[model samples]
Target: MFFFFVGGVEQQVRQVLKYGAGRCITCGSKADLVEYEKVLKAFFVPVWRWPGKEQLLHCNDCNLFFPPQLSADRTTTAVADQPDVLRCRFCKEAVEPEFRFCPFCGSSLS
Candidate 1:
């Protein structure tokens, strides 16, 4: 007798709740708040699907779905308080104002 099983679970964005709601933790790009669903697949075909418990942030550039609390740009108000800090246009990470290069993304600040 032979038995084989090939199945896995994956999360998918069900709907976008808000656009540009946050920043991606992995890629430092804009992320959207979205409702999500979990799907169970068998033999590459979806067998079951259920709604997720809460909304999450979805990065369009990287196709990553993550918790809202895990976003890199969680402290928007804090950044606004610090005027001397410069943000990298490429990665959106804060950099020292005097630095000519972004330490996070190696991009030219000048």
Candidate 2:
């Protein structure tokens, strides 16, 4: 349906380095691999897409997966548009948006 734009993913990836290693989604590590799924719609049905259509992130430091950014950027126009994000007290992995608790280590933000 809607393309995020060519190499747009890379541009977004670059933003993370500026933010530094955020809270880890798994094990609450300072670094981690993030995994998530995405879907696209066409005529009211879901279609296969690239990258964000579904994905995983890998971290050399801690060897885990976690969500990336915790804060919204210039692109987001509304509070809702900002991802569901969390910060780990240790290791620093950014947790997923809809997680009830940390997916990596199962630590509760609650």
TM-score of each: 0.66, 0.24
> How far out, in Å, is residue 96 in model 2?
21
lDDT of candidate 1 over 3-107, digit per residue (tens): 999999999999999999988766678899999999999999999999999999999998889888766553578777876767876666788888998776577
* lDDT at residue 82 of model 2 (Cα atoms): 44
Where is model 2 more than 4 Å wrong at Cα? 1-19, 32-50, 53-58, 69-104, 107-110
For each candidate, what is the lDDT?
0.84, 0.43
Off by over 4 Å in 1: 72-110
lDDT by residue for model 2 (1-110), tens = 88653221120121123223444444433543343334455554546443443233445455444445532122334633545655444423466657667654567766
